[model samples]
Target: MASPPCSAASNFDCGLEIKTRSVEQTLIPLVSQITTLINHKDRLKKTEKTLRAIQKVGQAVGVAVGRFVAVGEAIALENEELREEMGHACFEARRSGTAIAQLTDVCGVEQSAGVDRCTVFSDKMAMVKAARMLLSSVTKVLVLADRIVIKQITSSRSRVLVTLEQLERVSTFQEFVQIFSQFGNEMVEFAHLTGDRQNDLKDEKKRARMAAARAVLEKCTMMLLTASKTCLRHPDCESARINKDGVFQRMRLALEQVIEIVTDARPGAEPKALPISIYNGIQDFKARVEALRDCVYCVPCESLAVQLEALVEQTEDFTDSAYTSHEQRENVLQLCHATRQDTHNLVATFSQDQQSIKAREVSEAMELAILKTSHSVSELRRELHNVAVGRASELLKIHSDHAILQALKTAGEDGNLEKVADLARTLTEQREQLVETCRLLCHISGTEPLEITCIHAEETFHVIGPQIISAAQTFALHPNSKIARENLDVFCESWESQLGDMAVLLKEINDVFEGRRGDKRAYLSLPRPGKHSANLKTVKATKLDAEELSTIAKLGLELRLVTSDVDSELERWEDQNHDLARQCGSMARVVCSMALFTRGEGVLKTTLDLFHQAELLSEQGLQLCSLLQDFSTQLLDEERVLMVSEMEKLAVSCQQLQACAKTPVQGKSATFQKVDSCIQHTKGIMTVVASLLPLWHKLIRQCQSEHSSQASPQHWPDTQLSPPLKEDTLNGKGSNGFGVKSLEQHMASLTFLESK
Candidate 1:
């Protein structure tokens, strides 16, 4: 091979063959590997996108599963239908979880491939299958959850509607309260379910739906409570007319039920020793008192007012347990005292109507009830204050100990001897202050001090101090080494754990103390023990004075005397007026007959004689009317004026009759008949005057009665008077003298003559 010498064409041909072999052996494979790597990179990107999508789907499924589980737990144990549905939802959620797990395993297996050349096509297929399965399961669970939620919503809505309808139809208080309580319970359940579901739901829309439902329930509860309060405060008086006893009984029952419902509906994880205002305890107490006050005036049945008062007292006693503040309790007690006094005054007023003994009995019962309620409130306030003071002191001691330990830890870590010493002194001072505070609280609350164990805090700080000294020495020996830092970090971590424990203990104490305090202010801020004396003095100052009582008695006596005098005068005037009117009528008739029979000068002389007699009678009537006016002016001035005017009209009519009769007949038959008609009309006027006399007498008597009954003289004239004379009297048969048979007969004679 070494000896081969070739020409230029042969050499070129050999070089070309070698180059072709090299291209076939190396470059083609290298290019093919680069193409494979690019394809694999693209497939990986696609797989990663598919994996992210699957993860999102899986997470959504997980959240759906959690929601379904919560829904299952929230469904009432007694509701078989909802429970079954919840079970189905939970099962679907579990199946979804299994599918998601299988999908995750597939993704892990696909990602386990070593080379980028192995595409994740199998993983993508698995991801799609898993996603489909998860979607199916999640969809089923969501549907079940929706169905359960819808069912619960429908049930709650129906219950609320029924309760509201029943509330509207309720005629009695008891029925209304029962329905209200039922409604409140349903709403509470609905809110609780919604809240639980909201907490579990990850979907914003579903959570929003739950929040909206809860808000609706809360609004409905508030409206119902407001309605109950309104009814209790100002009950319909017209409803009482239908069945008063039943209405009162029902009202009492309803109020009690409403209070119970409000108490139960209050938002607290646990029942408080003292009730919070959120329960509407104060409002309910006020409502109960107002109800008692209102019912006292128009109680439907005998003893109903008494029963209501007793119930109010009992309610006050119950509400007293809810009062933790001394000021509020004292205020309520004062209000109760005021109500009792007001009721007494009301009873006294009612007693003036000849019901003294009954009023006295009712007042005594109310007084007893109020006294008992006030006593209960006082006792409850005292107990609550004592409890609060004791609890606050204990909690403060715990927190102080925790703070002291924390200070000690920080000072020890800094390796500052002066600061450590100062912290030690502070810890000692804190201990002493805590002890003194506890003693003071115990003395104020009238209770024994509770024993507290703080061994852990002491031990933790005791070890930390020595550890800090060791760490400082180690740092001095090895400044650049991590050993000192590591040691200090370990100590710090251990101290942190101790501090965490102390914090937890303090937090527990705080929670307990705050819960005991409820809605009250700090116990130490309550009024001093002697504040009750001032309140008592204020209550006593409201009593009426002896001078006022004497004035009232004197006024009553004067009224009675005036009434007697007026009554006697009215009777005497009625008789005198009747006699005078009858005499005038007789005289007029005689004159009319004389004029009709006689003519010319003889008739004229007879009319003059009649006029003289009429003058005397008219003078007597005028004197009687003047006397009536004088008496009526004292009580009924307006009536007196009307009577006087009528008397003047009668006198005028009499004068006209006299003038007509005095005219000479002189062979004129028409003139004589006209004179007769004038006399008849005059008799009719006299008859009207006579009829009005009794009415005037009645009005005078009424004024006397009114003056006796009322206290103020200004109110006396406001008394209602008898109605005016009827149309028959003014313009009908009475005015025409047809009411009087004698007058009618006389007028008939005149009519006969006119006809002839």
Candidate 2:
């Protein structure tokens, strides 16, 4: 019978049942999503909520799911205890029958059938066994019922696969109505019983529960999409409904995904080949150089300065030691490595230019273009001086002897021997003084003591001694004594030759210090032939593009800024002024924050814009990182997820309890206990989720205020704000009124399901 043509009363029954089922299935997920969205409508929503609630209630609002789990655990423990009790009773009953013979033997007494079969004994044993069996059966039934209920809760939402045409294609609303009732009944039945048998659920029930969960998740998603569309069309009612239904949860998850993408950053935009370690190394090197420079700059002397000139020369040679700063060295290495890798990748990935020049050729040429300003050669000169200075004292003594000998020879040639004695006395005294001075300075560079070699001392002494002797002789002899002066002339010539050789060596060293002899090309030119291959047109055809040129210029500028000696007071003054400007910027931010809170969000946004400009100017990467941390604290919170999960759990528990009420074992204590456990669990989770709301709300407030305080670019101060001081009292003990005793009591009362 095609049921009477849609009678009003019949239609009401049918429509109401079908719609009720559909709404139950759809609403849970919809609510979950809305809850999440509400959490993140702005970052501060949860934080503000948490703060206000904390201030009002003086209690920690924790996630509902945590409470739910705690309750579940308690129930599981109680059920296990029941099972053990039942097992023990069964064991006793079984032992009473089978082990009677053993007992008789042990007691040495005859057994009587009367004792075993008597009404009183048999009744007592039967009652105990029945009670145990009843408990076991009830526990199993309740567990199964709970599972069924959970499944239904997870699958309550309707998924209408039918299109408009398909719906119209239905033979009659009767068939549609019957199908809807069947599905709805199944969902409702499962929802009611699952609460009863939550713990002792079987494999099939577990699978069914999982399937239902998945289905519910899908349906929820669809409902959310529908609701969102509806909100877009006629937002007022839909928006309110969405909030009530908890559709905000899914929105928050979506937003989080987007945030992750934004924060990841692009690969190519990362800074060039300057390793962080290298930067630190350069800083250390800079410090060393600055200390050395300060030492030199403080010294004031003219004659002592002249005496200490060698030490100054050595210091100049060591100045290049700063170039060995880890940063500069690593930077050079990194540049080379990156260039090589790029070239290698290109060569391996693509065919080399056959018509054009080879990459190797270009690389060689590039290598030749790199400059090296090493001070190794000057360092070698200093080393050589240390090597020879020790012999200075011995040479001084030998030279004095040579002077006396020369004077004697001169006196003899002039026929004035008396003057030789006087010269010898003066020469000996001068030699002693020279020897002592040389001794003091001998080990100045910490080299080994230098002994005068017989060959060198003799050669010098012989040459100079004869010259002195000849001079003395010439003075004593007649002005016309040509034959007597011939020997003197020969000696003088020898002495001049020796002095000229010594002078030539000394001049060579002096000229090197004065920048006269070494090849300038060697200092400026590259060691390798192709280090600058990237710049060579003949080797690899590439024009100097703006980006490439800019990169090269930036690199050059950074190197110069770091490496150049900025020892002047003016440079220090500039640094101090820059610091003051930075401090002012921080103060400005605080002011802007106050403006944001008092004036309007627009003011805050203006302030932020100005802050960004100032931040860029300051080049304070660490400070920027700190700001990012603050921003992230405001933006990202996991409370939304916790809230959604809690709501779902609570809905499931309610459904399971209702399902259990309809089951055959409706009056079972185990079933009631299961329901109680689920309810407690749900309550716990709710508490936990609620706890985080205030923190989220506070964060959102901060974020909004920051945005409103943005400053104008033109009038923006060349400064930035310091980070806000943290409030230690905000989350202290009194801030949350859950004392130790209260928490322990709460924990003791709840049944929590331990996750596998």
Candidate 3:
């Protein structure tokens, strides 16, 4: 069910507070129709023109309310818990619509008859009573729909938690595999539901919090698979038990956070003191020492010494870790000691010139000390980043070679237990190396989110090692069992998938260390096809520089506005599978990606990718014209002409967009125009789409007679439009718990099932 609009209709207030973009959008036309009918008093001049206007508006409102009530009744039929309340609301709304329609029925007949007929609507209080009934019942129905959405999310979460418990308690490889498959589907459904909820959220902090919890689940799903396998492989191994248990515990905690966020429950765990990383120390120390330039002797020199010592002390987290290399530990210690000495010297300079604080000699000493300290800390931070990111990069390259996995696969088939044992031992050593590396990286990863990712990595490697061992053992026991071999293969593939995921994590850590946030998914999303796909000996980054990004910020914002308008139109359709609706939705999705691209934060890598998508959007726009022409059969002659003309304009804009996307431009000057023109033309297409969308929607509802109220075009459930999909489609490898197809597909399928 759609959430109620955040703000009720202008001039009409409903007490429920519902805030979602989709719901707000869908209600715009409905509210406009009602507002027109109820506000005839705003213009008291009831001349011939005014009477005609009121009659027309009343007819539109009656038609709209009839269709809305039909949908509400269908929803009531499907959701038993909401049946009685929804049915009452629908009945009242239908009655109010009928009264208003009948009162306005003869207001525009022949002059003398129209005068006599006007008495039916002359009772102002009756019209007012009907308006109130319409507004109140509509609000209640919408609020009830919002409740259903919340309930759907709660049920999905419940399903996931139940499957999670079954997974944790499983023992044998056979049992674990069966339970894990169920766990995976439930996770995918949970992901789909929460992802929708995340996108629908008006609160950015809530969205961000939801995103973090979901990321944990995404990463942990793989870890859970490997950890369970490892526990089965070495049931008696203490480290394996510790590793698997840690993964399950973390996953459970992340799950708890998700449910709490959805239910709006207060967090149960008290917030703990955040760990102080070297990066945090460097920033704090620089801020403190920089302040000394303003007030040298204002604070006690002892305080400066203590603060400097504390900054030096934070480095111990890195230097003292077992995973820190000998060379790295030495470099860190030297830098920390040097930073302490330089800070002490700066403090001493201030102390020595207490009386003549402005003396040049003392000033020079302090300045020199400050410069030395800053340089030392900068070098210290640079070294730490290199050790952490460089080690991860090296490990990834080494692990990319899957020799151990191949040998295990062959040995398991050949029934070579001794060979499998040796391979398992080799895998264990590699796991130890990765686990320690995660610890070292986590020490300097800096941000809490990155740190959480690092811990997840460690848990994954720690657990997957034993899982591989266990899978090998199972294969050795059932050498001829195809299912056992396949199980072993799945575990091995998960290890490789984790390694690939680690490579991504390392890059993210590097981007953060360099202070670049998660803004370049587009570069990674776009394919470097043709010549670009080759391993270049040397080439420039495809990403736009800061200046280019700034130049396009206004255009990007406009892109977001227009595409959102297009999405708003699509949201009103009950048959989201309607040709025009699907076409527009697909275009809106690409526009969304392009808007993010303009901000240097999406999956498109270059202007070329943006052009490619613009071309696709234009093609979809032209196809929408064809669809609209076919759908015009339901509209009146003049209405068809108006809608068709508007669509023709959209098609023309689409042609311009298509031409702009295909045009080749070389230099920076030409390239900039090429991209700007493409996006600008697409915006033009959307503006046309916005104008005609409501008319098309009106035509669809016009077909909703009593005989066909439950037909496809008028039938709406809380579910939006989506393609059908099987549950096992979610079993794709390395998907991070989401299906290979879009999450919307699976989310749609759940509603589809309910409707069926």
Highest-scoring model, TM-score: 3
For model 3, residues 1-756, the per-residue Cα lDDT tens digits are: 122222245433355455554555556676676556555564366577867777787888889898889999999999999999999999998998888787666455545653555422365556666766776777778768777887887888788788888878877655554566566567667766776776666554455456556655654554565556555655775545665676678678777777776767766565443456667777777776766666644556557678767766766756776767899899988887887788778777766655584643447676677677778778888887887777778878887778889999899899898998999889998898888778767767777656766676786788667867776776776677543565566567658756765776687778887778845432122222342333323322256654466446445645655564565456556767766677778878888888777656668988778888998898888888887777666567887888778877888898999988877655554566677787778767776665566566656665444225354443222233223322222222122433222222222122100000
Q: Summarize candidate 1's per-residue lDDT along 1-756 as a digit string, tens digits.
A: 111111222222212221122223322322232222222332355465666554554555456556545655565254576676556656654664555444443245455667443222444444334333433443443444455554664565457556656665665444444454455465455444444444444333333233323322322232233233233323542211222232223333332222222223344454232222211232343344434433443343233235335534633432354323466556545554554454454444334432455542445455455444444434443443344344444545466345555554455455555665666565555444333333222222221111111222333345344443343333333344332333333333334443433443344334443455244222122223443332212111111122222212222222222222222223334333443334434443443333322211123343335344434434544554555555556645677677767766765665565555444442222333443445354444445454554455556557657666556343123333435433112111233333222222221221100011
Ranking by lDDT: 3, 1, 2
Model 2, residue 634: what's the lDDT?
A: 34
List model 2 lDDT by residue over 151-238, tens digit each.
3333432222222113223333233223323333343333232322222232332322322232222222222322322223222342
Worst 10 residues of 1 by lDDT: 747-756
**TM-score for each prediction?**
0.20, 0.16, 0.48
Name the candidate that leads on lDDT: 3
The C-alpha RMSD of each candidate to the native structure, in angstroms, is 45.9, 43.8, 20.3
lDDT of each: 0.39, 0.31, 0.66
Off by over 4 Å in 1: 1-42, 45-123, 174-179, 190-756
Worst 10 residues of 2 by lDDT: 561-570
Error of 3 at 725 (Å): 26
CA lDDT for candidate 2: 0.31
